[model samples]
Target chain A: MSSSSSADSRRQFLRQFGLTAAATAVAGPTVALATSPSTMQYDDQKKLGFAIVGLGKFAQQQMMPAFKECKHARITALVSGSPDKARKLAREYGVEEKNIYSYDNFDSIKDNPAVDVVYIVLPPGLHAEYTIRAAKAGKHVLCEKPMANSVADCQKMIEACEKAGKKLMIAYRAQFEPFNLDAIARIKKGELGKLRQITADHGRSVKPTEEPAEAWRVQKKLAGGGSLMDIGIYSLNATRYLTGEEPVEVTAQEFSDKSDPRFKEVEDTIHFTLRFPSGVLASCTSSYSIQEVKRFRAFGDKAWLDLDPATDYYEHHMTIGDKDGKRQPKIKEGNQFAAELDHMAECVLQNKTPKTPGEEGLKDIRLVMAIYEAARTGKRVKV
Target chain B: MSSSSSADSRRQFLRQFGLTAAATAVAGPTVALATSPSTMQYDDQKKLGFAIVGLGKFAQQQMMPAFKECKHARITALVSGSPDKARKLAREYGVEEKNIYSYDNFDSIKDNPAVDVVYIVLPPGLHAEYTIRAAKAGKHVLCEKPMANSVADCQKMIEACEKAGKKLMIAYRAQFEPFNLDAIARIKKGELGKLRQITADHGRSVKPTEEPAEAWRVQKKLAGGGSLMDIGIYSLNATRYLTGEEPVEVTAQEFSDKSDPRFKEVEDTIHFTLRFPSGVLASCTSSYSIQEVKRFRAFGDKAWLDLDPATDYYEHHMTIGDKDGKRQPKIKEGNQFAAELDHMAECVLQNKTPKTPGEEGLKDIRLVMAIYEAARTGKRVKV
Candidate 1:
């Protein structure tokens, strides 16, 4: 990091955190009684207040609801072009009116010491812009994935955060997903011996010609690429985490029906194969025009672990298989969004880097670009 | 076809078929009453007898047993290199000693009018030789899937049958499997709307270092090309039939661990994508080093049909899914082997082309060879 010393910046960050906690305590004699039941699950002094940028469906539906269950994170601010939506959500979350900031004045969030983190959940194209601005505002940044449109943009986002001495973490919820974490733990324990193959298929029937809000997902400027960028990254990222290795090479194939107006702006499907140094091959596919399928499997010489509907927002199922037979194993489930939020907050308070930081997000985008190159050139590409 | 007059040859083929049935009728006036219960289930006179060539486990377990349930076919002869094994099965099935022939004396089966069709169930490498020899013996041929090891060989097998005025059929039981047929029927009737993509994953945990009899499956001389020729063909063939169109191009990738003894002679994993003329793409994969998986799905605009453990010897399941939700559909199942045996016999008796004819098998082999080329070259190859 370009900071004279990251420890010094982190100390400064915690000083502001300490001051906010002291102020909250001084303002309320019975702070424990005033807080919501969910807040009582964990120490509120260790928690970080986050300002969520972009009140999109994903932000409103998945993130806001998950905040109520977070042990180390709380919604302190809301940034949106729509003031009414932001005001209503702020009132519901007991967020002060002073913490509400529109995109036009998002820069002024720097004065609000209550928000120790700015979570950028905007479209991919705007990720770099908002992340850089957020870093300049001296708050740690938690950005949504497919970090940016290009490797250059991803690098710039990372460097911008480093220059400002603020930590930047890409919000990859899968890293905190319990079922996926269990699969990785099982692989490490040799439950599936000598992992030889990994297969992941994730897709949904998405009509790109729908409302502009949904159609932006297929626009090159907004989405950067099609299924491989939007949905396929899940499998790509999963393969990496499953093997804990980088792919040496990749070959990809993609198609989109031109006659279908939904595919006029972007490809609807992509299939790619990755070769890791251990000789473990991963075959992955993602489609916007196909049936919904969220499944992945890690195959080995002795047995295999399969997860059907693996990466859904909730309720993931797992099956273990061998020559004898297949059996479903019980799993302790948790909200992925809440889990990631707690993890990110923990990293901030402990002065540690997040598991899925900007560099990890950059690597995923690099592989996605390579997949596009291979698919376009009709040949294998070195990763 | 080399035949100067196909109609004349078909008539001649039916004349020989009629002669065999008439001879059987004349030999015994109480034929219907004297035959086994299985044979009495159908018209004894209308049934064409099949010479079971190569009494391997596949023939003995799947075919020899299915004949009892066939309404238009009956087992009349047994051919094998192992005399004791062939003789034992011959006795069990009530085959005359004269009808049983060794590989060395296989050509002499021509003198036995009771053997109207020679079912070649040998390894892929030997399919062409046996098919041509059977055609030369002037009998209709029901060869196993993967007509031969190469496209050139597949062509020769087809031509040999044509020149000898005998019909040749490839035994692709998937076409006759009840659940699969229902899926096709649903697609044909537009139950799933416009078919956009197809996916198939078929594999089994195979240790090629095991017994020689089972190890021959990984030998190029016997199995042709490891998993693709041995098992991957199921997904390849399924995609072709489900699309009802030939793939215009194919891209393939394969992997095997050099440290694993099971993959010493051939690759254990392969993934390929096929692009059809209608812009539909099919992603398929097969592996010898993974856990057992037999599944395929046809994704459409409205819904998708998934079959778990599809194309297995028995107990196929089907699930229908739409944007509304997923539902399991009850499918009236039938034994694939029995269904195919009946279909092949009906084709021979009616002088009609078999649903999975030698030409169909030739097309599949052509694509399989193309897949190998793509996998080796790491480039897309036109079919």
Candidate 2:
């Protein structure tokens, strides 16, 4: 709302839009403009030894494989209830047999020198416990997002990390992806014009499964919430990272088919709209009853940025457009998992704050809670 | 909500989805399924004549030229305040100058037997007056969408046409577009599985202008509403057409920079989310402060149909996707304006009700009012 800053922004907008003085000379002046990543080190010693927690599908399929490409991070230990699977992965990753520990013995990892950081890749309900335990065990923590089930839990995890003087980074891999990074950089340059509106939709059909292990995501106690906690968090986090603005208010509506056992404990779909202090509006949807549609699109006054399949483990296609038309800028491909993994390692080495630290994750949890509140009460909830 | 009807739907869903008995037996019986365009004939008659009631940009640029491709409608009269421009267009399009009429004498078209239908292509604020007058003139009426300024006005227009016994069609051109029709058919055939969610976003940049004629759209009285009435209607109407259901409720939010003179009289952006009776959720956005982006995408439990630039006047690209992948099905190109024009002509010739009749338009206006009310009151408004 400052006049001088807006004048600077208007001048920047004019330059980016190819507007000349002659055009502005005849036309009048307009509205006042609304006010609108990381490093690491690994110099001294061996690569940071990360203990893989909860060796689930994401761990075995994405994280462990991604560690092979990481310059400053490597999986040196494993923790899982399935000892046979853990031992196989430990051998595959060249971890000592003693380094493999089950959850019952996980706290004893404090005495082990191999684990420099504990990466918590558990269900939403277990994230806080594991993160806080790992912090108490004197290791830095890299946890998956939706940080935890509740804001209080997330705060406890952050406090545990802070009290122990250890870094707590939420592994928001999208923030580190090269394509998303390019979009963030371009928006900061005023290349996409002043951001006006944003849309984020991420969904996939989820049906009831026979296996209890496979159905934990649909369980309220395990996943914490429903589609919004799992897939919907991507849409919520994208709005924040894309605009770099916290929403002032949220209005949300949810649909849960109670007769469907898959949705009896969790929601099927959650659609929410956000109002930002800068006057940018965002409409987002996260659904468990629909096919996969990962979309993050933002429209500025002059141009727009769109990321189709905006988030996944590996690669995302991004395109930005203007009056001349759309173009997919070629960005050097980088693994999001690897980028985020290495970032945590570097942050620990340099004693620097992680870009998506516990506090950042906590902000999203606050918004998610507000969204659910709005949906439940049928009213707009302030964040 | 009926059990027998739901059984029929489940059977249809299973057959269309290629689901086998084996898959259903293991998954178990689940939630009851959520209870989830057009024609014309013109024979033994000369082509119906259309009198274009506005010589505005849309009329001059898109509609007049599309008449060349129309099979059952042709330009026979002109109505405009500017005589020179109207006469020039009339002559160019092979219309006699005697058929030219201004607003003052527009009602006298009743004596001209050549003008069989009046195509109301004027601004949104003028639709009711012209549609009613055209109906009183004993001519069938084809009014452009966003029917009228208010629900009451739209009701009056519909009643006037019904009282005069003239066919009144709202020109929902997308309904007549072949690609959109293909999407509609595929959805009805269950090719897209059970419809679950809809997303529509349409926006473009607008700047302040000196000319009154050029700036009528940004004026509240002249245009009735801002971007919502002009471009946002595409997103709103698409949700209805794509799902073939009326929204039960609407929650909307608006953002307009009052300091910007262009938005002082009207909103700069309006975002709305709707809930349909069948549990399908829709999120829509319309803006005047951003670059052009037209998108309409629907996701079913099994498949998705997307129409990029869904409501543009001419050719639009469409893609439908399932588990196999996205495919752009080739649909024979059709001119939307001409299609709607000929549709009205055919309805009049056959004495059949038009697919997008006055009642349909009135329904949309009522929803639009609800949307505005929702935005202003910061509450969910039932449609």
Candidate 3:
């Protein structure tokens, strides 16, 4: 695809998200790779420089590799507790030694003009702290999902970013993926007729049965809830976007077998139903003890569409069924993480609101808390 | 298929249902068409005779035609409020003039020994009335789904049948359909691992918007509770039989736009969530204003299975997914109504309990009432 066609596609894609003119203008201009003023020869000053905090597995595997495909974003610095591992990845990715910093001296990043954006990819308990600190340090923040451990923390982070006049975006990468964007476009166009219901699920077995629950994700204080805070948010967010409606009430149930070692500290599964104000209902489930299963199916009065592995990085695909017949529409595929990163970069440079700001993240957190309440009380709780 | 192979398959199928020895013996022995002692040459005394009440669209199109494939069942009588229509279908299906009766003279069926089973295919309000009259006539009863208009009526029908020393079965044909049976067999065999959740929906558009509400189904007094009574029962019953567990609580919501004439007296849509005692949860939806959408998906710890158009007569198909990959097993296809009719016939012939008895239908009726209460009050209702 040429740059002009890419720009057109991005325009069409961002339109479904209701992006503003400033965001659209950022997509039209091309930024040439410019070296930093300091000895960091690999740093591109024209592109938004991202300081990646927490060099964990997901950051190293998905986000680091995705920077190669981003047009307006580049990783300029790394902040990690392990200096040796951070130095090894910096050498492989061509980052200068001066740009690399350990957690002990993370506050010194404010002095580095090379880092324009701070991407926090730490555990749930640390998200609000780092986001507020980054905003105070005069840098845009791209925080990973679930915002924080509680709704109060999310609000604090949002207020901090607003006080600092810095852009704050949540890493809801599915909102930027091509397949989900196409689905939203079709629904908005009324291609599937009046929306009625949405059903989605995301599940995967993380490790072997014999594995111990030593990971931060299995710790309740660090991860917040269980699978709901991790993967269930995808289905919940998908329902909101597909129907363009917020749920009015929620009822839920949690399941965990004591015999399963992985669920010693957390729940293994959760099933919930969301009743929308328009009378549309969504059935959602999330599990950490099941084989890979990711799907989103939207039903309307005239037709239906299904997306199996709906939120995957590469294998996401869709099938639309109507009176004519079922057919798989050609959906453009690209790096899932790069689009969100570029969007955040554009939002910062243009001084515009991010598509998925702190408010959107807080909305999901409120629903999650309601779901937990419903499950605990066995009643339908209003959202 | 050879006759012996067919017999073997029938034996295997009936075994899953736990048929009595006499029923199995009847399957083993091939019986030639035997004439009745009277002048009705087409009537076979060896087969159970069914007196079909209410010659409506469903009985005329599906149930009557299915008798041709049933080796143990044959249509021997017709009872209708419209005598002309009764005479018409009776002639076409080879029923003697003396065997046909009007609803006014329905009690006279006791004089005809050829009428062994009374199949009631009327509106929900009339099911209990006809079932009780048929039971009093010393005939087994096979009633269409939603068993009756209320739980009290269902209980009364069961009591009347038990007093008459006759079997009473609900026409939950999906339980006997080959595809659904295969799916159930696999689930029982642990092919999908430990069951965790079930999601299902049944929705369809019936007629144009301008059509008048002339049918009895649109009246609350006759049809009970609209889509939930008409179609939602499929998904509800499926969750029960598939999991072999009854739901302990339910939460539900009903939707209908007043502008739509069809829903002026009834709900056009309903969504409900079921929580089983075993911690298994099922989310189900039904609608009367959507295009055909029938599906049932069961999720488990190690794998999952999906059945699109799960409750259809001929189009139902299933796909299983596991660690190895996804695969579609070739499920046997046959006349959907034949198995249920044959089972009822064998149950009467062998003096055995019907697989789907009146008590089973009453159990579902109790849950249906609970669901309505939950939807009305917006609170979880214990079953």
Candidate 4:
């Protein structure tokens, strides 16, 4: 639809919903329709086209189903290393045959106007390469987290997207989840007063009991460090987000046993402290042998925000507490993945930025690097 | 009231309340009635007389009122440098004229059987001298917090008390407070699962505002340091009590301003990390110029225990969050001071060891000394 017609339809939709539409038009035709969908010409909702780049277990089981339920976005293309799985998923999702692309033929999708955004669900090692390549192919990128395995990789991905003039948003779904967002809002609004300290931990028993001799996760070159880079990055990111300050220094300790075959390549558990500029310190831990899911807390003078099972894979809850009274009310039953998908779509259509931007991902990667350095040197590391 | 009659009355009170009287009966004759009183048993209270060694502001304000409400305890003697104020307070509290003792005549309280316990509320530098003398005098002791300024002093005080066979308990009131005790109980019960991280921060805006330096709180010899020894020691004690673990190592950073006259003799802020044997790491900070107060968080696999404004001077709140699919429930409107006082009374009357024993205080003092050493040497110090 034309920009004027789309704007008119959005206005009509807003009016029907008893909401006011912005008078001025935004940059794109999609922006106008996204802003006001009340009195437009088109009756059908315009869906932003998304493409899945990796047909891994997570994509097959979680992301694919989440996309099906998304109102603003739809899966239109598939790119995978496995041709059989790619063909099956593409057919199941009703994508056109021409929209299917292999790893080697991913660049051809640049000219296939149907795909507007590419969600990079590849392994940790390949995230930087695919993100850069996708950006060069003129597609907005939603890269899965740890952003890239290293700070340099994150910076490169961000620069590549900047050069290509495409949005590069890291998929830190926690930033978009309702409970966590509420926590962020409460913290930013000074509901917790001056944040004095933060504590975050994420762990789970991911030990391979009777699996293969060596998985990609157990490989240092592919996954970086074991728990710190894999799951501990969440603790680091969430702490920074809640405190709203970059850490000045870090002191960390790692536990790894070569005798345990699972920990042959990387550390099994890691603990670190981040000293912020505001004098707020964060104590964080991540472990792969522990059966704990997620936890986070931000404490201040007047109140505090705590999330128990904070980064739960599926559901999460957040609570705020006042100094004199009990904990503030909580927002429960939040789906991080669904919330993130919707946010990404909003960022694309509305010309906004994702909450977990490339810079944020880079900062976490830097802290992670420093933690690893500190653990190795047996000394505090400045970031 | 005779011991036998007191015991009978205690049993009657316990039976009326449907409680076990056997617990109090085992405590012995002197404690029989005090252990389980039906009302504020003023007649049977016996009035164990107390001698305030240092008539400081805290002693005059906090301890005097506490003693007034204490059924079995009374401020019968005063030892102070300010004879005029001591005489005035002694008359007001209805102490016998002969019970009023000056600093030079403090030894007289040793011979006077009227004074049973000597409360050392003196400066940190003076704690060693008075506590030793009080121990020599064979008086039970309840020294104010930081037990003594140094680890050596803490050790000496404990030894003196042990040698004299008189109880020495530090005023680490958090152990007795209901909210803190509840948090400890929840943590010990494994309600939050395996304890992973402990975070605590205690700070206040204690900066002087052009007033003449009147209080001993700003003096290094008196208060030890700005915030760490004054309020931050509570965090240290709370972490140990809540985790039930001793930290193996500590790394610290201290900030002081030679330019600011107020901080010339002490640190303005300090940040430290404690690594426990169970791999639970604690990040703690204390500041004198910060606009924040006490907080503590104990995180575990299944849930967390959070106390924001944890060290509420008047009121406190405890929140327990479980991974049961919703927000954690909170216990509110808790009075920490009254609970702490009652617990101390119970310990004395029932002959029970306090949760915050002299040993706990000594451990915290050792940790504090290690933190100071680390800050000075710019290296991690083993505790």
Top model by TM-score, which number? 1
As a TM-score, model 2 comes out at: 0.88
Give the C-alpha miss distance for residue A178 in model 1, angstroms: 1.0
**Which residue pairs in candidate 2 collide?**
none
Q: How many residue pairs clash in all the candidates, one count each? A: 0, 0, 0, 19
iRMS of every model, one decimal?
1.4, 1.0, 1.8, 4.7
TM-score head-to-head 1 vs 3, winner: 1
Q: Over the stretch A1-383, how does candidate 4's per-residue lDDT look in tens digits?
A: 12223233322322321221112112111211112112222122477777898776678887777775676777888875455556677767766656776555677678878888899986676788778878978999998887877888898999998999888788887786777778888888887777767768787656454432125566666676688988898899898888777889888777555677878987877878787887676777787765555888777656667787677666565666553545547466655677777778888899887777788788888888999998777687888
Using Cα atoms with residue i matched to residue i, what is each candidate's TM-score against the true structure?
Answer: 0.88, 0.88, 0.86, 0.72
Q: What is the C-alpha RMSD of each candidate to the true structure, in Å?
A: 10.4, 19.5, 11.7, 13.7
Among the numbered candidates, top DockQ falls to 1
Docking quality of model 3: it rates as acceptable
lDDT of 4 by residue, B102-211 (tens): 54456556778878778777656567667777887788777778877788888898899889877777777677566787788888988878776666877765644443
Q: How many Å off is the CA of B52 in candidate 3?
A: 1.5
How far in Å is the alpha carbon of A188 misplaced in model 1?
Answer: 1.8
lDDT of 3 by residue, B1-383 (tens): 11213233322322322233223222321221123333344545688899998777789888899998888999998875455556567767888767776555677788789899999987776788789989988999999999987999999999999999999999999999888888888888988788888888888765522332225556566678788888999999999989998898888878787787677777778888898887777888888867677889888777888899799878777898887888898977878799999999999988889989998899889999998998888788988
Greater lDDT among 1 and 2 belongs to: 2
Interface RMSD measured for model 3: 1.8
Writing each residue's lDDT as its tens digit, candidate 1 over A1-383 gives 11112243323322322233223212211101112222122246557999998777788888888988998898888776555566667777777666777655677777789889999887786788788878888999999988988999999999998998888999999889999999999998999888888889888877534543466576676677788778899999999999999999998888888787767777788888899998888889888887788889888878889888788889899999888988999999989999999888988888889999999999999999999999899989998
